[model samples]
Target: MSLNHVRPWKNIYRRTSRQIMVGNVPVGGDAPIAVQTMTNTDTADVAATVAQVQAAAEAGADIVRVSAPDAAATTALREIVRESPVPIVADIHFHYKRAIEAAEAGAACLRINPGNIGDEKRVKEVIRAAKDHGCSIRIGVNAGSLERHLLEQYGEPCPDAMVASALEHIRILEDNDFREYKVSVKASDVFLTAAAYQALADATDCPLHLGVTEAGGLVSGTIKSAIGLGNLLWMGIGDTIRVSLSADPVEEVKVGYEILKSLGLRHRGVNIISCPSCARQGFDVIKTVEALEKRLEHVKTPMSLSIIGCVVNGPGEALMTDVGFTGGGAGAGMVYLAGKQSHKMTNDQMIDHIVEQVEKKAAEIEAAEAASAEAAE
Candidate 1:
């Protein structure tokens, strides 16, 4: 049972939207909110790009987007698509021909701004290619790249302008009778991004791709994305998310999952609930958590662990997690398993011991899940 079941206020009521497929992964409706990231490598560099895509996929990316700026990149995209474990979305900009080439190259989806991809005739051709290749389209509207007319009309980029840009592109797809599409209205400003997404949510039933575009380096970008994406997600507005950071693409996937996990919208590895240590502590809470995080990265079964420095709120927090260690006197602390006080362990042995316990619990959960699935079959 989830904590949300007992606390109604914690529940998030997602907006109703039609579902679309990006390869085998579903976006929108009742689907698990998908996490996505783009490759930083040159698209033409098949080996490096493939390596990054595989790494992101192994880290839990639902989909990976690769830039296809020209013919050579689209040609290389063919190999990347073939090599990727997850779906590939070809990111096309200002070139309808590149969009067509990407669709024909076995891309599951194309991320393009319909307004900027030449005229209606070009857009129709791209849509035809998408339909023929069975590719879904993503209408990406960024604040930095709004149409010249929209800038003239609105005087500057704002939430209204971004939403207007999205709707205009959406109209092109709809005019062509193409419905297999998602849309994103993104801005670097968190406020503008949230407001634009809210307006877009009400204006269309298309799945929304959420992001705070060009969000700074790793630390600053993570903080900005978490605030912007977190609030929108809490409002039940996003279908898929990409964290745009000037960092490794794998970090984007990790941060996207972290945002979803914090909102209880998605669950992946261990969810550690730890307290910041103080003078009353009995163990090195910060160092212990850092070690546990790296050591337990391979545990995919969703669970919780609590590591508290002292008994202030230690025991109380332990009661809610799958495994816990609450610091105490005499060089040892109490260990709780399955939310109950189980035993005591010395500080020196706690890290390795907790890893073993988590692994055991994960295996048990997997076995039980397999049994339930087998019985259902």
Candidate 2:
């Protein structure tokens, strides 16, 4: 049973938007908020870019974006899209030709600003290519790269300016009879990102792609994204999300899932609820969790595990998780399965034991779900 079932207040009333397919994966219309990350590799290096995309897909990325800044990159995109396990979004800047080339190369989506892709002729050519190739477009509006007119009008890159820029780009797509698209209004500042998204959410029914652009390196970026994306998601604004970090794309996928998991919006793998160890901890809590995380990365089952330091709040937390370990006296801990004290194990052997238990529990869950579906059929 989900916590939301028992606690109605936990429900996030998601905003309804028209769904669009990014390759086979669905975005919007109550679909899972797709997680996205961009590869920093030279797009011309097909092997390297494809490897990065695969790594991110294995880590649960629903979509991956690769830059197609030039003709060479767009040519390489053909092979990259062929080999990629998840949807490939070709990132295009001011060059409309790259947009057309990427669409021809089998990109699932094109990330372009219709306003920046030269005059109406170039924009229409890009739009026609996208339509001919069944590619969705993403109108990404960033505060740092706001149009000069918008900047002059608003006198700054504010929420209003960002929203206006996005609306202008959206108007171009709408004018071109392109509705198979999503929009994003991003900023490095959390307040601006959240405010723009909030305003945009009210202004249009298009599926939103949420992000805080240029959000620094791993730690700082994750924090900024969690705050910015987290708030908008809580308000039922986003339809898909990308956590912009200066780290590896795999890290971005992991962080994106973690954010969605924290909000109970989406779940994948083990959702660990471990405590920061204190002096009262019977086992090495930090090390144990680190080992468990790496060991259980292969488990794609959505489940929770609580590793609490002591009885202070251990048993209480254990009661809610699918599997739990609570520290106790004499270098031993209690293993709780399905919220019941099932057994005890020494600290030295607990990590392996916990892994085994979680794997067993996940298999059981999968089997039961399969049986239920079979019965329905």
Candidate 3:
């Protein structure tokens, strides 16, 4: 049962979009928004790139992208694609040949612009390669990298200019009879990103990929992406998302899931709801949360955990979460399971005990889900 069914105001009506496949994963339509991250390693080094892709996949990336710059990079993409747990998107910029190579190398999708691929002949060649190799294309238009003619006409990187650029790119693909593609118009500015994506959403029914390009470091980027992507997602404008942070690719995947989870759009792994520690805390709330976060990273079950500092709001918060711990006197805390008071334990045993409880709860959830699936089948 969905909470939105009871609270009508909490529901988000998603924008309608045609569905496409990035390998086995579905995008647009009723598909859960796919989370993506790009590897920063040199693509020529197959070992490093494959390891990075696997790490990001482990962190819950539905799709991972790698740069296929030169011949060397595209050559290595073959092995990387074969070994990757998730679908691989080959990022090709200013190189038509690289796009062809990547498509032949088994990239699930090719990230490129048809307008920039030399001439119409070159564009057709790349599109043909995509069709031949069953690769979908992503027409990514960044505000900072718009065409010179568009910049001249608009006199700036505005939403209108971004949308115009994306439409033009879309036209090239349409002209070539290619429709298996998704689109993204990204900018570093949150306002610009939101406006561009919203405009694009109204313009076409194609799957929209959301991202605020070059969104700073971990802290700043997460906030910017949350604000920009969050608003767009709330309005139901995005079909997929990538949190472009200047951090590890795994960090990007984690942030993407967090954004989706916050909106109740998608759920995977444990969702920790911890309060900001105050003087009322009976134990080290800050350190305990940090430890729990690391310890529970391996649990991919979708559920909630609350760690509150004091009894003031802990009980209320616990009533809604799957597992919870509220601080109390005498260096002990009250534990809640399935949103009900379960037990009390000293602070020393709390961390290990919570970890054990979370793991057990995750297993139970998985088993129930398996049973439900089997019963339905």
Prediction 1 global C-alpha lDDT: 0.92
Name model 1 segments beyond 4 Å from true: 1-7
Which stretch of 10 consecutive residues in model 1 shows the poorest summed lDDT? 1-10
Off by over 4 Å in 3: 1-8
**Where does model 2 exceed 4 Å of error?**
1-6
TM-score per candidate, in order? 0.97, 0.97, 0.97
Candidate 1 TM-score versus the reference: 0.97
Candidate 2 at 125: error in angstroms? 1.1
The lDDT ranking, best first, is 1, 3, 2
In terms of lDDT, model 3 sits at 0.91
lDDT of 3 by residue, 206-249 (tens): 99999999999999999999999999999999999999999999
What lDDT is obtained when candidate 2 is compared to the true structure? 0.91
| CA lDDT of every candidate | 0.92, 0.91, 0.91
lDDT of 2 at 83: 97
